[model samples]
Target: MAKVNKRLAVLVGCNYPNTQYELHGCINDVVAMKDLLVKRFGFDPTNIELLTDASAVTGEGSSSVVLPTGENIKAALSKMVSQAEAGDVLYFHYSGHGTRIPKPAHIFGHDEAIVPCDFNLITDVDFRQLVNQLPKGASFTILSDSCHSGGLIDKEKEQIGPSTYRAASSLSYKAKNIPFESILEHLTTLTGINTSDIGTHLLESFGANASLKFLTPQLESELFDFLKADEGILLSGCQADETSADMNPMESGGKAYGSFSNAVQ
Candidate 1:
């Protein structure tokens, strides 16, 4: 294999302080991702940095620090990305509760928002800003183990997941559906897959793929194929209609199942 460039991993778990409202599964997810990078992908443990609610400042190999809110999150991200250079791969993994806010004026031109932490809500525009800050040729991989992430799929339809106004007032957002209109559009033009055929193929493949029981084969295949395109990869926990479990009944003080963290573990 050709020599691989240096890689930096940022793993965050939000289960402790400052995030009481949102369950913190980020720490576990980060730890599991770290193990995968080191044991399976040959990444040097020294290159990894983990931030959670329980760690201290060590500045050593794969150290952990506690972050309670969004301000701290932005600062840490800025610092880490500053160290990134060409040919570098930056892996960002976040596991926690996701809140929606009214859409921002710049992107959606409506009222929809997702709270990233106690201090601030992360809008699509905010995410785009972060992405724009990255150096060219740098690969950015983001895995979000939370609800309402389908918002990343398209800006036009900010209202995904069963209409937020329906029954069971406790459930605010739809948990497991990925709106693939844009993805289908892109694939259709690029690969000549008819839109209708694309949907059929995606459905068939997502439903049949057994590796991930939570996702239909068509969705799975679409996501897998989409990731292969190399633009960006997003792996959510469940379909838009389903709710991902947060606490595994078998474990205590640790996050539950339905989180992608369990799969990564």
Candidate 2:
């Protein structure tokens, strides 16, 4: 008998449509990965949940398209983890914008995050928490196809350079990250709230859409416990200081896609 497919996945693709932070290929990346998982990995169709922006005009995930909001993404991951047993395989693939934050208290000396469509910052702390909840012998692999994706799992060992987000020494592509301050500025323009405190403004504008990591800092001990979970694996697109390029239609044979995500596919 064929082995049962003991796999689950939460795929997220945020293009931030009609906004200044618009991306061209994130959704394409997600769709391609879904296809790869279904055909090659044989993950049950019912076991794969998709979250994307605007339901994807391509109609790939239109049947049950969940928006890539911060809460929805977190909840989906929670649900996947809750259903997993020992030795099961879990995967999270994020194709969107990513930004870095200055958090001296974090084990990494900073925080890396993927930018949900709503701009709620899901930090490394949150990913660590997710991994910690996984049952022993389970594996949660994360492929982040966005800028500053390095260190997304808090204490994961580094395999690349430019330890923090900064100007890449030399890159020819545009980074899918808005400076953290610029995100605040954008919110200010729309919400008419001007403050250096990102958590405050995000709470005001996006409300519950904002990430809890910004609102409530997890205790150091709790964070330590989260990091101690060794089942998490990270496939970051680039070093924190470097940018990941999203190929536009012109560059990708008339189909837009994230460069890193395409390579993985």
Candidate 3:
């Protein structure tokens, strides 16, 4: 294989329209990132793929681009990674809703997943799998501006954080844990898949951190093992246990945007 020196980016933003979890700033965040990549990083404009609920028009006369579905996003990522050779740089940026999903039956920890426009989650396990496919000397970096994104690349060591979020004295942010059960229910509702393995769900609920636990060796594997990847790094918006904010700040003149994404831009 030819060792090609290329820089590729896949930027995804989702403002879930007509839904209870609607936000106003995700697409804007990706657009700003694209501009930064082109003007500052010297990334070729044609090499970037913009996927968002809103239209992306590269030039005045260019046609508006349609949003990507979950399958489309997966296919793009697969192609991006599969095409990489040594000395390639792959960038993935996501500004959207994120949540925790119970790891599939065989894996022990919970999965941190990005919520796609279609509600089909792309989990950290998926990302790790992709990173594993990267050729030697290739690198993947991800910036996830979403909730529960800390471990978004699976077993990678957290070099920057587990940092605490401290807003000004007047502003307060509280973190809440949504039960994994609810996520399973949402998945089932959306795709009619039987996500509930009742026996395993009950066992996982008993606190994986508990000292006195009754679980078989197989169950133990579900709590402590993860796929390790050496080629990817994740910069997440919040600690795994915290929630990222979708801010509608006054400075933006009444526009909603992801606070982390705005800061990065």
Candidate 4:
């Protein structure tokens, strides 16, 4: 067994406040996960980077808080991976909406992605690239609590999310989902460039902030570029075709939370 040396983490939660994509429980999810990592797992608070909505995580501390934008999130991941070595363990947890490409799938089946607060997508190809960069003996684990997140790691099959056999519930439930059409509409409205090509819209609007994986499709050489074993792990909330839920449980006094995240905790 590999003797783990240091434990590092990045926790992201995006509520997208006041927008049509607004969620109610992601902030709470990251905060709770932070506490769990500190108390239950052995993660140093200083070594972990927490990203979420500004208004939600206020009064938590005086540390420099970063918003969960695509650029910022990617930067955080890169920073953590850059510092890792053999026997080190890294963890990433995302609580937010997820999406998938409806046409010309990048990886052949579906190109799943996580929708950052700014709507700049971080796709499975991006995650694959990040994983390929990990140093040997370094283990990176991802826990994604978002809709259509199962394929966030290219060709991942660890599907575990919502089920049709869900017990009856009267409380409100919000799907942590942003359809391709909605994303296109939002981008078109922002850039005034009506095009079905999401990559073009993202490139026009966010530029460098947009995920390069989407902007530039991963090449065949790149796919075979980093072939290693046991360096990366993905624990997604649902299959590529499924949608997770942000739900208000009856026993929680009406405070909403992610169904998948809640179950995980």
Please, what is the TM-score per model?
0.57, 0.86, 0.77, 0.89
Summing lDDT over every window of 10 consecutive residues in candidate 3, give the lowest-scoring window.
Answer: 206-215
Q: Among all windows of ten consecutive residues in candidate 2, which has the lowest summed lDDT?
A: 165-174
lDDT per residue as tens, model 4, 2-74: 5558899999998898898888888878888887888888788888889997555422454436899999999
As a TM-score, model 3 comes out at 0.77
Could you give candidate 1's per-residue lDDT for residues 1-265 as a string of tens digits? 9756888776666653452244534555677677888888777887876766665333334456446355555556566677776688877676665533322235633211233434233333444334555676777666666655544322223332443432332222223212234333433555565544443433343332211212242432344332222323345453333334355333334333334667665
**Could you say which candidate leads in lDDT?**
4
Candidate 3 structure quality by residue, lDDT tens digits, 69-158: 666677778888987888888999888888776545546556677777765556666676687778888999899988888988766788
Compute the lDDT for candidate 3. 0.69
* Candidate 1, run of 10 with poorest lDDT: 208-217
lDDT of 2 by residue, 1-265 (tens): 9555379999999888898788888888888888899889888777888888866643243444688888889999989999888889999999999998766446655578888887777888788778888888889999999998987887778766554644442323456887887777876876786577777777887676566566565553466863563788899898876678877755435777888899888
Q: Which rank order by TM-score, best down to worst?
A: 4, 2, 3, 1
Looking at model 1, residue 210 earns an lDDT score of 11
> Which residue pairs overlap in candidate 3's backbone?
108-222, 108-223
